[model samples]
Target: MSGQGTEPEAMKIVLVGHMGAGKTTAVKALGGVDVDELIESREQRTVAEIFAADGEGAFRDLEERVTLELLADPSVQAVALGGGALASRRTRAALTAARVVWLDVDADEAWRRVARSPTRPLARDERRFRALHAERQEQYAQAADAIVPASHVRRLAAPIAALEGMPAGAKLIWAVTASADYPAYIGAGLITDRRFWPATIAGRRVLVSDRNAASHYGALFEPVLTAVRIAPGEQSKTLTQAEVIWREMARTGVTRTDVTVALGGGVVGDLAGFCAATYQRGMPVVQVPTTLVAQVDSAYGGKTGVDIPEGKNYVGSFHQPAAVIADTTTLGTLPPAELAAGYAEVVKTGLIAGGWLWRRIAAGAAPDDPDVIAGCALTKLRIVAQDELDTGVRQLLNVGHTVAHAVETVTGYARYRHGEAVALGLLAELRLAGADALRQQVLELLEQAGLPVTLAADVDVEQVLLATTRDKKRVGEGPVPFALCIEPGRALTGQPVAPAELRAAIMELVG
Candidate 1:
């Protein structure tokens, strides 16, 4: 708030995240005050002498005293918080006025940094260090309004400068994935980054693009491989397209060692990923999703497939891609309708992943806002990374999709794009069944984002029921486990709703 309207005015920048994320280094870059100097000033007083005056209780008090004193100076604007500061609810609340930046670092790099640094108090050994690191990462993630990856600090300085100019409440986010750990680079401008694309795919790679996405930004990927263009939209996301890509792969003499690059949105990601999954009994796949819908949700996950006349993604395999590249620059070319449609997934993500993230999205934050997009993507990645097979906790990601997918199926996929239909379905389901406040928030966000809150008149309730009957989430001889959005960051499933009630709800939305 203090830096408002001034280009070079000082703003309080607080560093947060897991231990050893180079918070100190970043603070040094900003010419921050030295904490050790303050401690050194009192060197004559031993730990025993300090505790003797107040005991362990008082010693803890002194720590906060020193921290507060350090932050009191107007010139001392930049503060590097200890990794555990946010763990203290009082500390996080006190720092509400400052610009909180969560320094994003991968688990492996963080572990290595802590291992090499002897200054860390909690990281005395590898086993204990990793335990502490993992525990704190989630809390740090929750506390920050914006996230900055410390992995490329120097390189990202220019972008950081640009980000610093954002309004007081603006949020920015950056997505990062450790090398070969799992395919995680699904962000704008990431596909064009040489760091994301390995050298191995140069001559051996083939690119598959759909009409809508291929018409623009297709040239960006031309350097990656020989391009094979396909028709765009949900209709093109079928087994036929998969076969065509397979044929291309075969004609190009692609082998098991070779990779196929999917350079479009979700449809292309699914279709080309399916080809990579089945070809030569499974080959490498790289995803370059051009739309916000694909980048934030579909592209990173391994579930690749084509829709059959029977059900959605019925003919797909769990073939994980080698990497995912998303370029935000491509999003600039999207129609306003497309951008609004994509925000549906962003809302759903908030419903499932709660806290400040839910609050931000509910507040009508734009998807292009780094904080908004990164927060949404981080929630998805955390869930998927923990349970790639979706055998357990990952089922939460399907919130609002059950009825939404049914809407798409019954309407023949053209009435609304996948995201638009989902937005409508979520509204109906929440209005009828979820918590009142959350339902209202979802409705407000839908209206604010310029998406529809009701289904088309032409959609048949009976056909929608029939579509629901075959949902992939159906459990042992009962109603399919539909993720019902109730509270922000919470979902309920396995609650059997009567078919009559569901039909009534769909009818209410109809027209």
Candidate 2:
């Protein structure tokens, strides 16, 4: 086929998702050039006919060729991909420069749409169809630059237009609630924005950050606040460090009206927030999370505390920030290991949310993508809004954290990253909950994300059990409230499990 010659790199919009995700329909509704016309202009048979005449492998090769050709055609503005087309790494790699949109559809609805179609080879068996859809959903997520849910497909024109018009480095805001509500901004170069500083931060601003974050971005905050750099590491998240910050705040004449900015990862955010919670009976604080984990999870909720020797987060309070500024560009400076660790929380959020977000992460979407990070942050914010006190639905956020906290405590927070322990914790908890299929899927996703899937050899199982007994989730002399996965996007929280069963699950992780 001849390529459209000598045209500027026109923005090619590609629609991707599971079978029956309405990609083609949406593309048609989008009222752009007919992608199928271009395909038929090159080949005689449709994708379905090709699959029926040959096989999946043959169809995949043709799909890749056609997709590449279409993407190269400057004349083609929008195209729809077959459900499994993105499973080919070559196809995905080729489409990287194109504007890819994922039509996020759940398996049930997708099956309902395509079940009666005779030409779909992969949709023949119900169980197999669901599994295949689940698997490919992740691939679509990874390949997509934007995600439009199936429900929104009919109205895809507006969002697609907006995406086309959106400039790079644009800021998106999500409202997060703790004791008070605040805005969380996700974008590049937000530190330079004058509006990032809330009006409440007028007096004696104190910026708390770790040495690593301070060295890189400290100058941005220097113009406004007196900076306090703490030593970086999980061990530094303690009452002693919090006291040091408290003393510094006092010495700096930080009054109750002034704001304290937690300008690092979870450690600094927690410790600084704890100080804000206790200092002068609670001063307003702002969270400027620099790490992926902090951006998505810890920075939103009002939960703040330093870890005690007895357990993690043993000393803390529900001190919400006045605002949370998640400058996604800061993630560029994060080590690969730290980035992978942050993905565990993303996975955990997916399991709790169980829809497009879960599918996106399972598909290996870049953890640091502003939209992905914003989705996770908003998920937490919605849940926190409902149960700010952690008394009800909010506990679902702890799906993998029960044993995760124990592992952190038993190993003295040195052996594994918080998200790594959480990954292992997810597996054990899934096994304990008898969600074997979901467990295997999550295991594969973690492996793909380069997260640790098993407990370290030196980690003492007995010590982990001991730590669990003292977990804050445990009510007076009863079993700890464990969040157990029933399936993707579905979990039963605060479930009571026998000590023996819990121990057995923990032992399974000992590799």
Candidate 3:
């Protein structure tokens, strides 16, 4: 809270993100200036117009000059970087002294924000902006010491105030409690934040993370808590792993108050959550959901469990966390396929509680867009809050997931990322004739969103059907009920059908 209410100073803080991630808007706000006043340029032609006439190289030169001149002026209050500028070695080096903040936006919203602008040089007639945006996400992470959630931009004062007088990358407090009510504070330095680790875990806090996450974020957890590394992948979500985690907890003599930190993606979250829940009948768990999938779906809910080989999520408990920290920074390290897989939950969230939000995603919304994530998360939170127990209303949230989980199980989890499988399942579930138009529209959106509408070439339809039969959700002696799309906003649950129809749905995906 140190840097607030004071007159603007030197260029001590820098805002970075992919193109059209609202960095420019955020910078203008921080400088207490309007964009109209700052940009006294060569005719307000759209970036497209400039690129069409002068070309990309010309635009890049202009951009570089604008960036360099701004960074040089000590009086420059704050600076916002165009996405490509950070890619330059010289420009990045200049930022070494400043507190760099990354404005994380999803792909669809990124496209939406830039789509309205005619002046974007990058958006110039690029149909592959989705793919390209996905490609550059990791690059943005390299430049940021702290990631500022775009969702918090509207409520800028609190987050910015939290950043005051701290070191360049010191963590800022950013908690979201609308529905699930979780605490999250980010930045490279948050590891030391009194708020980051609960006093509940006094003598020592034990953190469990996978190999991949340990390599990246283990350092952050190690100094504050005793972190134990585990292997990665869904296979790790097993009773054996849970026992190992419990043994570590027991060996450490962890108390009810002592916390267990689940430091990886959903698998870690699920396994660690289950371990924490089962230990002492329930222990406080702090979820640091690393992957996009965990952040948007698995991490927020109190539902934690491990999958038995017989089925997914077979044994578990409702172990809510003291806090759920979603560092958008971690998502920057995710691979392209992993990124796409995360979007499946985003799509499902939109389908169920997201009335208009589904339309946004169905239109091939960008993940770098904050609005898309906000809308999706808000809807998801609403549903999760209502059905924290998931008996009735919240069941709609599984629209594509019934078939999707089956797909993952049958394909042996390694074949397809959960989101990719869900994307395909969404297409299949949407195919029940009544929602044909909407189904086609969704398929088009999935394609535009750089996802697969059909099953993978290697997937065995028969195995998937067998897995579907084994799903715990099966009602009576009949085909398992699936949440199907009646329209964009309306989804029907418990829609029973003949086993043959279910097989045909899988067959259609295969064909």
Candidate 4:
């Protein structure tokens, strides 16, 4: 929170990531010095030459000495460490002295950039390079104060500077889609820092919140044009509700240039973001998520909409948020049931991620742990960045969502919380995928979180099966493509499931 909104002195900012993550290029783009270049300059030998002659053990020794010296220097405003510097324990320890940003790039993209590069000794083969990339993600996720895509680095000078003010252990995922790029900050005490809130500049902020969130943290962001409050819950998400906010905005002299601040859980975030998308033919919105579901899952993606009578989230648009600020402190005031419900997403995300995050969740990481929260957000942001249009890889994110939405739709969106239904959906989807062992493992996770593991006996299993036919993903009605999970870290989309097996899966969930 240094200097609040004022730009702090351009002090040391360290860039760390895997090779081909553009750490060196980012340093140049950000007008920072490159440590690898300094190493070559001092030794009068290229890094490849150092690697060939001194060997990795000797090269790491030299790297630790030179990297630590540059990091300690007050004159150096920014430094890009060697790609493997995080492998050095001492080098990782010295990172606390300055702001650290991890330039995230997928293994395929990283390989595409470094393949056949003579300067890169480590990128000798595709298999070894990818394994190295996967091995470093957990370390990078743990270390970086901010995670931004390498593609955005050349134009990311502003946000790279903003990293200096983040609290210790706080993480910011610089979310980028093909259409927009924005900051999503996950931390404690971020609300008190004026820098985290987006300024409206000449325009004013039109706050859209539910009564619950407005009562809890609404006053924290005052001086808005108007507080367009709504009742909380999935039942409140509708075209009628959106129109209510729109009329209020029109009455309050809201303009297209104004920003809409969505301050609540998934319901409010979705409904308000939908309003922001259609109002004046699209206005910028800053999402300030107050609930775990919103913070960990719904907040980062540009998907904003309301539920129709047919299904949940059936009406929506891809209106990317201008920014998202997730304050983990808000979870302290959440009810136990609500907090437990949100854990379903944590499990779903962890199962999909199946790495550091899954390991933490498996060991029972609290729902509000800032690092886990940031890690989940980073995971979704990375997925969305690769497929903003939800065409291919992004569909993996809907692993449990298809059945979850069906359960919500069949029950009229009043019976179960979204996450609760999702918990059941995950089990049913797991059963359909014939992953009996994996299903048991995830069932244990649901039990550990105190989330619902089964549907009530009174619920009509037949209706739930019928609802899946109307899923938004269904195009010509050949069959609804289920995103099946056969293992952790992967989910196959567009899999056609038989009616008999689908019915059996739902029957398993019914108590």
For every model shown, what is its TM-score relative to the native structure? 0.69, 0.66, 0.62, 0.94
lDDT of 2 by residue, 1-511 (tens): 0022212135677787888888777878766443444455567766567667787687677667777777777677788877777777777767755667777677788989999576576777889998887566546644555555576667765444434323233333334344464555566656744334433235666889999998888877766547789999888998888888888878878789888888899999999999999999999888999888999899988889988876677778898787787888899999989988998898888888777687677777888877678778766876787688899889999898989988988887778899998999998899888998888999998888899887888888999999887888888988788888798777898898788988998888875
Cα lDDT, all candidates: 0.69, 0.76, 0.68, 0.84
Clashing pairs for model 4 are none
List model 1 lDDT by residue over 1-511, tens digit each: 1233444225566767777678777778777753433443575554445545556455455555655665666777777766655655556556656666778776677887777454454555788776776566657765564566676454435334434434433344443333223324333444443234533233466878877777776666555446788876778878877787788778767788767888888888988998888988988887877777886788876889898887678888887777555566577777788888888998888888777687777766777655566677778866665567777667778777878888887777778888898887787677556466777778778888889987766677788888877787886788777767678756775556677777777787774
Candidate 3 lowest-lDDT run of ten: 1-10
Can you write out model 4's per-residue Cα lDDT over 149-198, one digit (the tens) per residue?
88876866757645645555567788888998888888887784443564
Worst 10 residues of 4 by lDDT: 1-10
Instruction: Assess candidate 2 and give its lDDT.
Output: 0.76
Give the top-scoring candidate (lDDT).
4
Off by over 4 Å in 4: 1-9, 161-165, 192-195, 199-202
**Model 1 TM-score, 2 decimals:** 0.69
Among all candidates shown, the one with the greatest TM-score? 4
Candidate 1 regions off by >4 Å?
Answer: 1-81, 84-180, 186-203
Question: Cα lDDT of model 1 overall?
Answer: 0.69
Q: Tell me the lDDT of candidate 4.
A: 0.84
Give one clash count per candidate, in the order shown.
10, 3, 18, 0
Q: Which residue pairs of candidate 2 clash?
A: 138-363, 305-316, 354-489
By TM-score rank, best first, the candidates go 4, 1, 2, 3
> CA lDDT of 9 in candidate 1?
26
